[model samples]
Target: MEWSVTNLACRRGQLRILEGVTFEVAAGEALILRGPNGAGKTTLLRCLAGLTPPLEGQINAPEDTIAYAAHADGLKAQLSVAENLAFWAAVFESDRAHAVETAIATFDLETLRDRRAGALSAGQKRRLSLARMVVTGRPIWVMDEPTVSLDVENVARFARAVEAHLARGGSALIATHIDLGLPTARVLDISPFTKLSGRQTDDPFEEAFE
Candidate 1:
């Protein structure tokens, strides 16, 4: 599936952070997002993921094909690693016989499959969160800083999983500072579309108003 965006303008409350953004990610492709802090990289990804509505423009991806992974790893603290993946698989109706198992193996979580999310170290939780993406079986992945708590080795493992997804005609749009080692990935700098109206303060939530 090809994901396309055109003239996307977005805001956090009344403050416009970005405007005139346009991009496309074709099947088997990856698009990396780059921008200075407060340039609306996360805001743009949220709009693409449909977590936030754009003030203007068109998103041409299929409604249910997008799977989003945000900066916050939204794991249920009480759920075991396996249980968490199972829950997401059910949520996305990904009834592929081995969906949950596949995800566990993909992220090397087999060792911790029975561990509660609250008990895993930061990197382990991050792996589980990304593993949730695979269980969803969505064609397009929209991730913001997905490598946050991962070590170099884990990051490479994550990159391999992404490569496998792309090999299956999946696409990804990611906002990250570190290189994911995706050889064919293209980068799009969002600074050109940034609007300073919401960047005056250092707080990311400051855009809620002025």
Candidate 2:
């Protein structure tokens, strides 16, 4: 499905962080969000994923269609690498064997299959978290800084996965500060949409009158 956002306004605790944001990602395409810290990249991704609501405007996509990967690795520390993927596969109602195997191979987690999540390094945990997104088989990926702790080789693997997903008519909305090596992907910088001074000028004339 094609994802579209129109005049989106996102807020954090009554603080308007982003406004007048608009974009679209058609099936088989990827859109990258580029901006510095506190530019509402994460907030925008969360709003798209339905973890939070947009303060205004509309998102023309269903929440269930999105597979969101936040900065934090949302893995069960006690579970083994394979077990983590297996658990998510079951949750997503996918074929446990196939999904788990695909995820492990895609993220190069085969050797760490038996290792507990807590035992893995920072990069390993991030890899597992990314693999979970793959197991869900969701059409739209809303990832926030997906390459946080990944090395160069693993990042390449992630790029391949994204390309393969798009090749299969899937779409992605990624928020990252680094280059994801996706040449064809469109870029959206969130800085322009950020609200300054925690206030919005609803009416230019009103401010003058005041």
Highest TM-score, which number? 1
Candidate 1 TM-score, true structure as reference: 0.94
Q: Candidate 2 has what TM-score?
A: 0.91
Candidate 2, residues 1-210, lDDT tens digits: the string is 688999999875546788999988999999999888778888788788787789899999875798999877999999999999999999989899999999999889999999999999999999999999889989999998899889999899999999989998999998877888998999988889988446555665323210
Candidate 2 lDDT trough over 10 residues, lowest sum: 201-210
Query: After best superposition, candidate 1 residue 115: deviation in angstroms?
Result: 0.6
For candidate 2, the lDDT comes to 0.87
Worst 10 residues of 1 by lDDT: 201-210
* lDDT by residue for model 1 (1-210), tens: 787999989886557888899888999999999988778888888877787789999988878999999888999999999999998999999974499999989999999999999999999999999999999999999999999989999999999999999999999998888999999999999999988564345565645321
Instruction: Please state the error at residue 188 of candidate 2 in Å.
Output: 0.6
Q: What is the lDDT of residue 118 in candidate 2?
A: 97
Pairs in steric clash, model 1: none
Per-prediction TM-score, please?
0.94, 0.91
